[model samples]
Target: MTDSCIQKQLTEPGQEGPVTVSISRQVMPGCETAYEAWISGVIEAASSYPGHQGSNVLRPSASTQNRYVLIYRFDSYENCQNWESSALRGQWLDKLDGLVQGDAEVQRGTGLEFWFELPELPVNKHPSPHKMALVLISVVYVLVISLNLLLAPILVDSGLWLKSAVIVILQVLLMTYLVMPRVTRLLRSWLFK
Candidate 1:
């Protein structure tokens, strides 16, 4: 299964900032199969929704029975709200009525907080500062060197400030929407360890 978010340009005119919604739930004993099926159906239904980027599921281990974390991504808050208010999602939740132990806790956020989140963990648990700095430096180094090499000639006639601004904006966008998520996911074992 693909574990990465779909690579799409998440920023466009009139679009709200990208959003991440997390749903944490506890399944009743012997309801894992039913819960899994319900989750699949919801994901399938969500895929047809506007601005749906992707999703990630973190199933509980033997040591963490009955717990599951579902992370969904949308290009904007409005789009995510649309999904949340949709009848299809309502139907899915209805199916879970007796199968789940209690009300699922939901959390939502935008910006770097979404990308930096660790699967199955609380938001307050972040990577160490040293690991974060290393990742940031690595990503920025590669982006700056590659982008500068490619854009320098094109922006040669432009003012230095203009060139710098363009590069900075591009870097921020790529880091926020693209590079950081992939890198963090790839290095999760090391970073989290």
Candidate 2:
């Protein structure tokens, strides 16, 4: 983790809401299997902690080189910090001495801001508020319009409020799980510029 624990201090402390921490680790050549095993163990250990929501691992791909990006979520910053600062986590990290290369790159964010993170970037940088807002506006517009058009026939007999509720729920789900990640990745260069 290197000085990432220190880096966390650079960001706001005690931030409310779900806290997401992205950890990027470059696995040494031929250590992929061992790293995977280690991941399973650490994830299980982390899951035992209070407020540990879950984790998703983005394995190395051509674009990501050998880096494995682990996204860990907790209910709040306090819980996240507890897990981060735990001796258990330290022990797990210490076991990585020979399994990976260099220190892990870590970035922490609250709520929607995590979507805008660029894992490959060395430093934690967020898109300007205006840029983020613009991209979000565009995404919401497209999603809402497209969803309405596609659902109109099926929801024709539904009441206005019912239809609106459905659309809103679907819109949020798509935005969180599907559309946003891809859009953020695609427009990262412009968004971050």
Candidate 3:
């Protein structure tokens, strides 16, 4: 990767929850096959790391040598860090040596950010409103059932406003860091199509 591409680090602060790291790389003119091999190796290595969730790759367009975007997900920041700091990751990066152009552009965020965009597409290309509503309803149903079961005793002793506030907070946090990511990915075929 080019020096310019290496400017930003993979994970930033507040990324301790379920996180998705996007690595954008410009493959050399004739090294597509080599780059794919490197990606497979990296993914295999990452899958063995603690807290590893899953990964997705956006291949370059058939008509152009565009950048390839690799999205890797992990269950927690500590787990992601362990993979990033490993000698195995370093070796994989080293293996890419001259197969890619400049340094890779890395971005990190909690997984919910991907819910709005169809995987392998530009960020603005969102899923249909109907599909989004379906997903939202499913999530809310799960959250309500879960919260009712887990917080029944606490809610019975709390004021109405306090109960509402606590429930909302829990719903938002759970949806953002856990539920949405897995749901969106699980239903990608229907959500995107």
Candidate 4:
């Protein structure tokens, strides 16, 4: 009900072959560490069960209600369900029964089942400066390298390695200032909440 019309329009509710599931949870007032320990244990144990892609824990953002997001990316839809229904899963869920407040909401995936034609994209279409900046930098690098070869001798003679050094410096600064912080912020947002 809180979702926007555009959000609804863009999504189709159904299972594709393989999908990641997100289980969001709120830590009981003082149970943050305990909640994490339990979930981490489950993640380690899931390896023996097979079909588990991996788990990403998201801490709650200031705007969000839930405090934690447990994202379990499964290799397949069936595999995800199997993990949910498995005996080990039951044990894990049982351990958290009263430790966390409210039931968890599991989002099947980021959308797009992924096939030969449509491989998985590293980042979703969210407003990610990290991804976009990287793409732009890559294109610029290709153009610069191609152009550099033509002007190579003169530039080299002029001690132009400094230009390349400047670019590398800029890259590191941008990554540190603009990209990595936001990424880790969101990553920890998923973890600590």
> Total clashing residue pairs per candidate?
0, 0, 4, 13
TM-score of each: 0.60, 0.75, 0.55, 0.51
Per-residue CA lDDT of candidate 2, range 1-193, in tens?
A: 8699777546565556799988889999999999999999999999999999889898998655568988899998899989999999999998898899987877888866776766666556888778888888999999999999999999999999999999999998898779888998899789878
lDDT tens digits by residue: candidate 1, 56-138: 78898652344788889898888898999999898888899878887777778765556567545654566766777788888
lDDT of 4 by residue, 47-75 (tens): 66666756666677653454687766676
Cα lDDT tens digits for candidate 3, 60-148:
87522378889888888788898999999998888988899897767776544555543355544557667888789888988988897
Comparing 1 and 2 by lDDT, which wins?
2
Q: In model 1, what are the clashing residue pairs, if there are any?
A: none
Q: Which stretches of candidate 1 lie over 4 Å from their true place?
A: 1-15, 62-66, 119-137, 143-193
Best by TM-score: 2
Q: How far out, in Å, is residue 95 in model 1?
A: 0.4
| Ordering by lDDT | 2, 1, 3, 4
CA-lDDT, candidates in order: 0.81, 0.86, 0.79, 0.59
Model 1's lDDT to the true fold? 0.81
RMSD of each: 10.7, 5.9, 10.7, 11.4
